[model samples]
Target: MLVISGAVQAGLAGIPGQSAELGISLTVMGSALAAAGWLLTVGWRFTRKLPKPASDIPQVEQGIRITPNIIRVVVIGAVLIVLASALFIPQVGFPDAFPILGMLVGFLWSVAAGLACTGRVMKTGRVMKNSADLYARWLSRR
Candidate 1:
């Protein structure tokens, strides 16, 4: 959605007197992208299925181990920075350049966030598969 909106905004950039419209589009798209990023990060973390413990460690001991997800943190942070920078689109001194830059930044950031999410999902899926396989092997050995 954001990518499409950015493309539309880019197309509208050639028209004169569209700075206001462009600015409005930039603001809306930026906010939407930021919100989506936040939701994606939260949803991903909340919905993630943890791999089953491979050892006989107690639940309390397992809960104390914290594995940081650096990719998610970086992606969310970049999206936020893009969102913040986007707020200045309307205030740019040159109206003509606003749309182009805004479109570029918005589109790029949206893509980055999307790819990050995809990678994380794939990684999680792989882990889940491996854990299932391990459990199946253990059952077979029983």
Candidate 2:
């Protein structure tokens, strides 16, 4: 809606002496529309019930497992991609030195995500083993 209103505002900009008022009105309307959209989305989310926890998955071990080394490699590869993108933003590009800021930011975030997944994997493995023990005990009771 904001984009549509912005285009309409631009089309109307040619009118003599109405540009200032038009700009002000469009800004207010655009801001209000954005706020209402945000409110609706958040309100809708609030109405939904939370699902079961991760442990509710039956026999997690039977599901596919991600090797830790692959996660590390993918993170490094993504950071490299970010560096390449930042260096070649122009159409006729003169490749510049690596962007330290962008690379550093990407590396930090990717590492954080990788570490989080690693921890989760370790915990899930422990939980899977423990759940098997419970299954064994349940079988013995029958």
Best candidate, lDDT: 1
What lDDT score belongs to each candidate, Candidate 1 first?
0.56, 0.52
Clash pairs, candidate 2, are none
* Model 2 TM: 0.32
Tens digit of per-residue lDDT, candidate 2, span 29-70 = 767887888898996667655332346444444332444555
Give the C-alpha miss distance for residue 101 in model 2, angstroms.
Answer: 11
Off by over 4 Å in 1: 5-16, 19-93, 128-142
lDDT per residue as tens, model 1, 1-142 = 4545556565657554564465456567767887889987996667746445344334323322321244445456656755665676565555665456556555656655565566555545454435557777766786
lDDT of 1: 0.56
What's the CA error at residue 115 for candidate 1, in Å? 1.9
| Top TM-score hit | 1
